[model samples]
Target chain A: MISAVSAPDPDVYLMLRVRDGDEDCFGVLLDKHRNSLVHFLYRMVQDQPVSEELAQEVFLRIYRSRASYEPTARFTTWMFRIATHLALNWLRDQKNARSEERLDEQWEVADRKPSVEQRMVYQARLQEIRDAIASLPDKQRAAVLMHKYQEMEYSQIALVLESSESAVKSLLFRAYETLRARLAHMVTGGTR
Target chain B: MNCPLLSEQTSDVLLDYSAGRLDAARATTLQKHVLVCDACSAFLAGQAEVWAALDTWKAPPVSISFNRRLWQKLRFRIWKSAVPVAAAALIIMIGFVYDHKSQKSQMEIDQVERTLDDIQLLRQFDVARAL
Candidate 1:
């Protein structure tokens, strides 16, 4: 039996209220997780609009499954589990739809009128970093995003990815190695 | 403690160590190894730089209407899901009312039949007295 002194997760408490037919609780949850969820999905899909749509779907799914929700783990774990599943599926579908469109599109930099040389160099380095990350395998990219952006632990990442802790670690290690190699010149403040 | 040299398999230990995930005993062991190993030390430094750089790649802020649009969608979904439940409840309530009305009518019919039978018996007794 669990100890009473160990309080439940605040999100879990809200979710329980949601399960009991309190729609307001769902709004609270959505407000809390929307940014993080969208950001996570944005990193995963690299498309802001698509990420927002997918994040909306994630909330819809959570609400739909509210009645059957169990506090088996942290609410964020379950939430990300759904988000990751949706993102992977979306990525897979996107991959099949257009195989040649895998390159990262040029993101529009802010409209600051810096020196031409400085701007070009900055854009190139930023694009290089984005491209390097975009080139990672799907699982590796997901693992890295969860670790780096979400700041999730390996165990939590494994739960979300449906993999083992060691597997999550291995994925992150490989992912960082790739990033390190590609961005080594940047780290050393040298032009590639 | 015998410090094991870092290998391909143990390379992840550097990552875990850099991320501050190792337990005290294991962290002490890896720290000892790093102190003697230049390669491992460099690896940790490179990884730390990579992590810092990755931190700069922030996602753009979501649109201002994100919450409003999401709330709209959620409300629609809730309304959509409620339709079936409402219809089912209506059907159940209608069936219950129909069953209740039928039972009440059956009881009323039985009462009428008993009153008719008593009238018939009274007429027969009055005819016998006349005879």
Candidate 2:
């Protein structure tokens, strides 16, 4: 059994308990961060099961490395540091293997209604945005996802991607540019 | 009304204007340029749609057993750490028990040797005849 203070949140206090050998503290941590982490990784890999698998691996690493965990950074920064590394490596390997051409696949539009034209339009729009994001070179996708989805400031993203803040900004700018170009239809139709 | 000024504002409009990362002064910086620039206005409009649509992309739901699986993994890792310590302790306990038994055996051997030495000495003294 876990205490109330430590059971509900993934705060630094709970993490401190985890560091001190409270195995259950990790369950609390997983509960708190699991949704967000899964979301972030899902945007990257576009596969639920793979993201879930990798998420588990990430937490396992956190637990295994708890002995050396320091308070030098926020627990999330350390956690995302590991997560971003795995994602970037996976992207790199996918590049080498020249993956299954996700740029043209409209996988994100699954499981929703398609009868009405508006719903179809919405679905198409979602697919366009997803495909545009997927078509971005790996770094740009990472930048875009890290910025917009993960809500990381430039400095935090820099830490995850191991780049400088200015560089991260520039990457986001480029990513935004690509997204804007590909999504020009949506933008143009916005005020029309 | 200058073309260059409008063109300069076009690039920055997409970065800060659309992402909502800009403050008042920076947003004001683009105001004059966007007033006359049709292309930039169109681009920003598109950004709004894309951003909104992207927000609807809910992640696939995590499995119901995700936490359980994570806990299982966590348990395994915890046990992995404890295993070495347990093994080392077991080894130490076994070594201690073996050393203790060897010590006991050595004491028994000493006692047996004393008895044998006494018996040999009596034989050398011919104690059987009670001379």
Candidate 3:
């Protein structure tokens, strides 16, 4: 089976190709990393459609910055560095545009619950987790996504965030602490 | 045993410990600290369970059309930016050819000057012969 051309280490080759006006390689890279990047952005933005659109923008940024690609760091680290910057900037712009943000209008998950009662319970618990995640400070939310979800080591995270490993750890600790406080009641009851 | 007020340091190390990154000696020290501190012990255990639950924190499935629409938008943007670059290259190529044509004309002009000078010399020789 001819699987999609796999991109392992030294994606510098792809970057170089992209520098030489090779948009195909960029497309391949985008397709390869889209799902994971989308998920990461989803965690950051807490909005599905917005995350998808934002992720495409991330790749476009990468494409434009092809001329400036240096192979000093792993491609993954470089990509997240850009992603985090974009997400943070997005948060800042949102805050500037609106004095205070509106609550997220969550789209319902279908067939995830068995009966009407189960559906209501599932939706409530889901909403609680969503709120807990949203209530976390932007940096902590980003740190949590990058560490817990992305499975990046602390050093890689430090590179992405331009912070020390200790700082990332502290951020994650605070984020986890916040989650514990907010969701402790719902953990067992799965209710409001 | 005197424990430092900075338990957060140990907590970070404990996270690394959970990830199996701590050296044997350091791990032993941290292991001892957790054993003595009930709060740290519970926190680590609680985080581990939360992490396990979070393993399922995946986003909902996106529509197939989502990828198509997103990539199309990206392509349109890139296409817009690329048009100018292509036009610039075309202009550069045209300029190079134009400069080459002018250089060839300048060489022909120099050759024509030498031909005219030779003809003048021949006419002077004919005039002298007539004298």
Number of the candidate with higher DockQ, 1 or 3: 1
> Top model by TM-score, which number?
2
Off by over 4 Å in 2: A1-10, A22-25, A96-128, A186-192, B1-16, B20-33, B116-131
Better of 1 and 3 by lDDT: 1
Q: Candidate 2: which pairs clash? A: A187-B45, A187-B46
Model 2 residue B100 lDDT score:
100
User: Which residue pairs clash within candidate 1?
Assistant: none
Task: Tell me the alpha-carbon RMSD of every candidate.
Answer: 6.4, 6.4, 8.2
Q: Note the chain A TM-score of all models in turn.
A: 0.84, 0.79, 0.81
Model 2, A28-80: lDDT tens digits are: 88888999898788788776677788898899888888878766555676778
**Candidate 1 lDDT, tens digit per residue, B21-128?**
778999998888789888888788888878766765667788789989888987898799799999999999999999999999999999999999999999999999
* All candidates: interface RMSD: 3.0, 4.3, 3.3
Ranking of models by DockQ: 1, 2, 3
Residue A111 miss distance in model 1 (angstroms): 12
Candidate 2 lDDT over residue span B14-98, tens digit each? 5566778878887886866677788667666766766876776666667789988888877787798899999999999999999
